[model samples]
Target chain A: MTLDLDTARRLIAGTRSAAHERGLKPLTVVVLDAGGHVVAAEREDGSSAKRFEIAHGKAYGAVSMGLGSRALMDRAEQQPYFIAAVTSAVGGSLVPVPGGVLVRDGDGTLLGAVGVTGDTSDNDEAAAVAGIGAAGLTAQPAA
Target chain B: MTLDLDTARRLIAGTRSAAHERGLKPLTVVVLDAGGHVVAAEREDGSSAKRFEIAHGKAYGAVSMGLGSRALMDRAEQQPYFIAAVTSAVGGSLVPVPGGVLVRDGDGTLLGAVGVTGDTSDNDEAAAVAGIGAAGLTAQPAA
Candidate 1:
């Protein structure tokens, strides 16, 4: 099923609340539908200008690749040139980062992805996981 | 004064409904906030693959220039070389087409922009205007 607007907004709210509770920096969160299109996005006050783009890139990359961005990051580490080529192929929209997490339903069906930016990669990932959990969804991050 | 998520979704739905009523082709619509960031976007089934990007480019260009895409199209016609240079400088994100319309609040404050792509440029413009009106907002196209 498609990730509806209400779910996407809830995901963003959850991510923002988790970021606040953890004392992370202002964050930008983006949710992309299964078709790799933006469903909803929000940039918290004090977030940098590029945070939205970065967050969107991460979510788009995850949905396009059908894997969490952490997996892409791991692959990029081993094959930087390949990842660069992929980036060029996609017109520079791919972001191999840790903050992108895949969203799945209870039956393991892919819904979409959530990407966060503005803090350390690990912290961003944590917030994403917490947000997905708070929304009662599954976050499938790369091992 | 912001384009909240609910407003953005309403604009998209209104655009889709207008397109359907007019018997236009499948369309992709995008709404950008005042900061030129995507608030919501959707590509209808059977729409072309690049419709989302084109719609987003049109909306972003409108918000960035604080005018409608029709105005940008006029400017491009008068100064093709300068417009080309600007397009190149922005990595080709600006679409000087007729489908982008500026959205304004009742108080005449700029809220954001909506872009629609699928049918002819004129039809797209009509759909964008109809969508904004249905959402109880003003669409400020060039005079």
Candidate 2:
């Protein structure tokens, strides 16, 4: 239920390495705890104003759904009427897309999550996977 | 940095899972892209409206400064005037407090950031970290 600062640092470092390996463009990473609260956040220079919100939303959507944004998007597609109505009702923070997942210990203990932006969802997902492994945790694939 | 739909879901899924496991109250998680734009967002059904803005502002601040909210809060202490000015200048999307970190990659690429506010700073950071890992990225430490 708790996240350590040392672990968080490792998570970021791992993500950075993965991104560079792939030669992805500038990216932003975020960490959230199990309680669905903010843990750590960052933005890169030249990142647009909207980028901040977009990153947050992408990750938020993934965290909220307990699945990758792409999976959620697929679910939303199956129920367009409900999804559209929910989006309209919620206004902000409800994103239907891919590129996010859940972080769990080997025993399936919850350990919070990580989100990445500034690239394709596939790349973002790839980076997230890399970070989770660096942190010594497991990334549950989208269902 | 560009924020996409895939990463959005990852952030939310991790955050929510953390909350669900920890028995924290219902929460609203928000992720912001590098440009401060909303890439994805999600609020727990029982969460209040206040959570939405708090999450947005905190995440926005993290991305805006390329650091976590906790780090930003510390800096604000040294320059209260500047922090206050930013709050007033950019309303509803800049909570200068602890709990959020800047999103970054291994090579220090700027992607996007995330923010959460349903719990304390520590809890917030936890959720943020969970989100980051869920997305396969890393969150920077508060400097």
Candidate 3:
């Protein structure tokens, strides 16, 4: 399945709806193309604008590295220098957080990703995961 | 125009080059997915720790709204409530600042955006814009 703009948009809308239904706080939901590009992004009102972009970075970084942003965050915690160096090496394209996941189709085909932010990392992750579920997509665990 | 991870990375690298070439302080750069979600982000060494997130927000907000952060900032000045409403509308996905630009392709599609911080708003905007240009993508002005 291609993570085209239409699909990406649907994912984001679903994410937003879940957040709204759950009375979740403002959230930043980002959609990426299979190539790890932006397809659709939206931030619930009153959520941190930064979350919108940061979530994207985390998701994109995860997609690019095939790992979750939290893993990077963990690495950053233990090896600040290495993480910092890599951060420097990549010119700031990598951020570690739990706000990212790969978007997959029914058969596990890579569709793209939906990243969410604006709450605790766990909540953010839940929101994104829920959103993906809403869209009939699966979220790849950050391995 | 699509904003792929590769292009986003190149844009970020170029922004850093420009900053370093000018001996600017470490900065933060953020790349959002096409859905105005974050795809990649980095905080330069010596830059504010929060810069990473803030810059990401600025860019994410810009992409989500399909407008420049600066314009959003201006709107925030007089219509704080309106800006606030936007934040609520998208779950806090709107940030009005001067450091974000829309990422587009030659065909003018909304791919995503980049935001930078750790310098003056002008400087941040410059870096983000430069990053987009370096990636061979168009950074469109706010409509």
List per-candidate RMSD values in Å: 4.2, 11.7, 10.6
Docking class of 1: acceptable
Worst lDDT run of 10 residues, candidate 3 chain A, spans A86-95
Per-model lDDT? 0.84, 0.68, 0.75
- For candidate 1, what is the DockQ? 0.24
- State in Å the error of residue A141, model 2: 4.2
**Candidate 2 lDDT tens digits, B65-142:** 777888878878899888888777766557777656566666777677777767677877787786677677888637
Clashes of each: 0, 123, 35
Better of 1 and 2 by lDDT: 1
Tell me model 2's lDDT, rounded to 2 decimals: 0.68
Model 2: per-residue Cα lDDT over A1-143, one tens digit each: 24544465567668768888998876666665565444454444344555554655666666665666677678788987865676566555755655465678889876766767778877877887888898889885365
Per-residue lDDT of A74 in model 1: 95
Model 1: how far residue A87 lies from native, Å? 3.6
lDDT of 1 at B95: 89
Q: B25-127, model 1: which lDDT tens digit per residue?
A: 9888888888777666666656765677799888878888888999999998999897788777766588888999999999999999998898998999999
Per-residue lDDT tens digits for candidate 3, residues B110-143, read 7778888888888777776766777788886455
**Candidate 3's TM-score:** 0.53
